[model samples]
Target: MLELKTPQEIAAMRTTGAFIAELLDDLQARAAVGVNLLDLEYRARALIEDRGAVSCYWDYAPSFGRGPFRNVICLSVNDAVLHGLPHDYTLRDGDLLSMDIAVSIDGWVADSARSLIVGTPRPQDQRLIEATERALEAAIAAALPGGRLGDISAAIGAVADEYGYPVNTDFGGHGLGRTMHEDPHVSNRGRAGRGLVLRPGLTLALEPWFAQGTSKIVYDPDGWTLRSADGSRTAHSEHTIAVTEGAPQVLTRSLTGAGLP
Candidate 1:
């Protein structure tokens, strides 16, 4: 349907994004070496409850997912990129952790994801994380009014190509509003001039994920977690943005301007 937000609706969405940004930051600060993954998940739930926000992942049922998701956030570890169901695993030093979360506030929804190292970071892992972050920034820059949706995808692809990382377009970004997913699916790679035309008030979640090795992905038997097919490290970065008359507005960044410099 390619839904576009009204000015008032856009403002509401920004409010939701602010809460999400703060929540992600808090969760990251709390996650560390020797911390239990389930503990982080619980913290997310508590914050969401306190703020009266609704988790987009809870009770979420899709064709590919096993059943209704029962978690408030996804905690993906090394070699795991997306849809990671938090378990009782304890974090170790140098472990790569990716956190993805989506929430609805006052009927508006925002989604974002980030990857980081638990304690001491590996140089290669740091590079991989930077690659996804750069790709995310490039995609955000390409999301301008009147620009084709492909422009955003192409920007992400170009960054990935430059970084020598293979991209998997199977599970990329998408539109979101009252619900978490919407029309005009956004892939990680595409022709710059193709796809839907961008317009003011168009909101999207732009995500770019890459694997150090093959572009293929493998699913866990739990039917919720997805990891790199070759067991290579992976990274992902994302933000919810809005297309305006001028530069795109990144709604999912923290108040400290934590996104691109």
Candidate 2:
């Protein structure tokens, strides 16, 4: 069911959102070459503990997930896109890394993800990451009051299409609140005037993940990490947003802060 958050609930959710954003910023700085994905998970757990927030991913057993997600955060590298289980793998030079995190504070939850290139980035690799960020920005911008869900989806799709990248329709964004996943599955592509109507106090995570070549993806042998079927590089960016009377408010925003590049 789509639960409209009360003003008090939204305020508490903002705290969780800030933590999500701050952790992503910290992870972005720490995801250097030679860092183990497990190390990142450890740091995330500590940070959550410090803030007294509960990780929404850890011990999370969902219908689509394999048993319980054993880590505090998701670490996707290179071809790996979503639901990446952190392991003993060490990040190498020019490796593309995606960190997805979700946490609950005062019973409200917020989720977000970001993709970055470790060490030096190649030209094409940089472009892929940039496209994902642009798509995310477009989607967030479209999440305004009176706007339709399709508007947000179309905005994200337009950016991906402009970059000549195919859309990955299998997994997209969705409503988030008391629980991690909620109502209104938000896809990366859709008609601009259809689907759910945007309203004040409705919070959603708008994510845009794209592969450099094709949209087709396959699950890793681990049954979690999603990777491009063609083994091409991928990028993903997301933000938890609240539809407001003013412009949409970005809850899970990163330190890169203002406008997209």
Candidate 3:
């Protein structure tokens, strides 16, 4: 069931969103070449603890996930896309990395993700990251009150198509509030005027992820990481948004002034 947020609830979510945005910014700064993936997880844990925030991924055990996520954040490198389990791998130059994190602050939840190239970046890798970010922006613009959910999905898909990337509906966005995931699954592709109606107080985590070569993906042996079946690079971008009376509000905009790459 979709639960709308009250004014007070939205206020609390704004705080949670700010924390998540700052956390992602800090993580992106530390995710340089030669940094181990496990180190990134540790950094996230420390930051969450310092802020007295609870990690939504630490013990998350969804139907599709392995036992418990057991990590504070997700670290996907190169071919890996979603649900990436951080391990002992060190980031390398020109490597495309995606980081996803969700946290609860004072009982409110906010989730966001960003993809960046560690050290030097290849031209195509930069383009992939830009494409995902552009798709996310388009989705946010379409998330206005009275608009249908499909409008958001179609906006994202249109941007992806313009970049010559195939849409993957296996995993996408969702409603977010007191929990990390909730009602109203937001797909990356859909009809322009279909699906649920958008209204005020409808908060959603809008995400757009794409693989460079193909839309198909395979699960890693770890039971969590999802990699491209064709060994192509992937990029993901996300933000927690609120449908308002006019333009939708992006709750998770980075506090560092460094927008998505």
Candidate 4:
């Protein structure tokens, strides 16, 4: 079912969203050459714990993921895009890394993701990240009340297409509220008028995940991480937003204010 949030609920969700936003800011700053992915997970856990927040990823048993995901955050590097399980791998210079995080405050959940170059970013890599960021912004801009879910989808697709990047819709955004995942699954590409209609209190995550060469993705042997099938570079950006009386409210927004949250 597609869940709608009450004004009070939305306010509560904002806390979860803001906390997640701040945690990501700290984590991204700490991610650098020679840093361990597991260390990122630890930092996320500490942040959540210090704030008395609960991690939605851990203890989450979605069909596509393994039971009780061991890590508090996703640490995807290079070809890896989503559901990146933290491992013993250490980030190196020029490594394109994506960190995905979700948390619940007083039972309200918010999710977000970001991609960055570990060190000495390459031009092509920077371009990919920038494109994904712009695409995410466009999608969020289309998420206002009275718009359809497809409007968001089309906006994101247009940006990706303009850059000649392939969209990976298999793991796009979705409705989020008391739980992390909800109804009315939001794809990365769709017709402008298709799918559910946006309305006041309708909260959803608008994420644009793309690959330089192909749209297809494959799960790693761990049954959690998702990677590009063509071994090409990949990027993903996302924000959890709410369709309000006028414009949409981005809950999981970045500190930079460039994303809808």
Output the number of the TM-score-best candidate: 1
TM-score per candidate: 0.97, 0.95, 0.96, 0.95
lDDT string for model 4 (174-230, tens) is 899988889878999989988787999898887888888899988998889998999
Q: Model 2: per-residue lDDT, tens digit, 99-213?
A: 8899999888999998889999999989998999999999988988898999999999999999999998889999999999999999999999998999998999999999998
Model 1 Cα displacement at 238 (Å)?
A: 0.7
Task: Give the alpha-carbon lDDT of every model.
Answer: 0.92, 0.88, 0.91, 0.87
Distance from true location, Cα of 33 in model 2, Å: 1.3
On lDDT, the stronger of 1 and 2 is 1
lDDT string, candidate 1, 1-261, tens digits: 878999889889998898889888888888888999999999999989999999999999998889899999999999999999999999999999999999999999999999999999999999999999999999999999888999999999999999899889899999999899998799999999998999998999998999999899999998989999999999889999999999999898776645211
Q: Residue-wise lDDT of candidate 3 within 114-175, one digit each (tens)?
A: 99999998999999999999999999999988889999999999999999999999899999
For all predictions, the C-alpha RMSD in Å is 2.6, 3.1, 2.3, 2.8
Report model 1's TM-score to 2 decimal places.
0.97
Error of 4 at 82 (Å): 0.5
Cα lDDT of model 4 overall? 0.87
Please give the lDDT score at residue 5 for candidate 3.
92
lDDT of 1: 0.92
Question: Weakest 10 consecutive residues, lDDT, candidate 3?
Answer: 252-261
Question: Which pairs of residues clash in candidate 3, taking residues 3 or more apart in a chain or in different chains?
Answer: none
lDDT of 4 at 85: 93
Worst 10 residues of 1 by lDDT: 252-261
lDDT at 256, model 4: 52
